[model samples]
Target: MSDNQNLLAGQRRALILDEVRRRGGVRVSELTRMLRVSDMTVRRDLDALARQGMLEKVHGGAVPVPEGRTHEPGFEAKSALETSAKYAIARAAAGFAAPGGAVALSGGTTTYAVAQQLVEVAELTVVTNSVRVADVFHTAPRPAEGGPARPATVVLTGGVRTPSDALVGPVADAAIAALHFDVLFLGVHGLSEGAGLSTPNLAEAETNRHFIRSARRVVLVADHTKWGVTGLSSFAALEQVDVLVTDSGLEPEARRVLAERVPELIIADAEEE
Candidate 1:
């Protein structure tokens, strides 16, 4: 009877988790009715799931935990945020990619934006750690109407993938160490005077360090929203940043401080239509 109870409890919690993920949130009372369990039992299940990091318990019930310093969000979730700002930042950063020069692009929505524009650069070589970014080049349209076909050569690193779709770990770090680039376009989960550049994934931070060392110039591409948000791991310091490209939403104080620390700061117009 005890074993059966344990199995039933496990199945109930699984159902509760599925409901929370699907509906975005769930009420304890509703869950009790749906599962035909007591309110206290539903509460216990919610508490267990929360402790296991599967969901977050709120006032009435439970919801998904918002991505925090340690909680990394998936690519789809992040890509939907700061759309115009990322595009603007990417446009400004892509200008630094010289034709015929080697460029390294770190994984993030903003860097993925940069990859889209780089497809037009003639004879460029791009090294990247994001499979999604690599796919941008891999699926780029062929030269139009028999025009000169000069697609940039893309080198993708191999490693374990993070929730944000970044390839990290020793394999990625080692791959980046073996090569060098003229410039590196890095996108971060957060940037600040203290944290500098950071990501929630520790392996990605280490891999990003390798990228910074392998490039002559490091241009950090991020939107204004990332200014003060610190992540679990930091990769580079402010003094190491050669340039920063961001949108107009950045505060004046942030701009002043960043301009003082970074060599150059470029603000792009991010007005959406």
Candidate 2:
């Protein structure tokens, strides 16, 4: 490559890494616009980073490498949706967890809420791939203040980080495969009868699959808004989910479908709580 070409390539790679760290991931279209480069140039840059293992390239974007734990969505953005519903779901989910049970909490807003509820529970072991979820347990107070002793153990999966600050990909999958959990609670970007549970990233989907396989039971936690929407990747089929926990706002037809498809469907009315 010529001097100018080499410089441009380096600049593009740097910008890609920066965007992944800032946003957790960056779509090719966004990178092309930000770098003022063609689609092909952006793809080339992503490929280079993938080769170096700086990031994991997916269908439309790239995920950050696991290193600094600071990468994740801002509190405001993540806390914007289904706040009440998430809490209710968290409450219901926590009820199913025994005092010393091992649980895998996947990354997502709803799962984050579940982690918060777990603060009051004693002797629970939580394995997660979310930086934000891990922080919840790490900062929880001791039982003297009427809280549980945080949690017995918190395991963070290592891998590429998504814009949502989720750790995913091969490293995360490997970690999940090595352990078995009594229950696994997952949060999805979308839920559909035809599409099942879905996420916006392929690497995350793979990581979720491993989580499902490693768990004795899989519980899906999603607000009503997730129903009917289709994301970029399909993680698990509805049949694979042992329980479906959703908000009361879900339509009657949706409830019927979930009841028929999954073994158990729990709807929590946030307004009632």
Q: lDDT per residue, candidate 1, 1-273, as tens digits? A: 233234477667767776886699999999877887689999998887777667899999999777678878777656656677888888888899887999999999889999998888888888999999999999998887767555558899999999889999999999999999999999999998888899888999999999999999999998887989899999889999999999998999999999999989999997742
Each candidate: RMSD: 10.1, 12.3
Report the error of model 1 at residue 168, Å: 0.5
User: After TM-score superposition, what is the CA distance of residue 7 in candidate 1 from its true location, in Å?
Assistant: 46
Clashing pairs in 2: 24-163
Q: Return the TM-score for candidate 2, rounded to 2 decimals.
A: 0.71
Residue 93 of model 1 has an lDDT of 87
What is the TM-score of each predicted model, taking all chains together? 0.76, 0.71
Instruction: Tell me the lDDT of candidate 1.
Output: 0.87
Local error of candidate 1 at residue 177 (angstroms): 0.4
lDDT (Cα) of model 2: 0.82
- Looking at model 1, report the run of 10 residues with the lowest lDDT sum: 1-10
Tally clashes: model 1: 0
| Counted clashes in each candidate structure | 0, 1
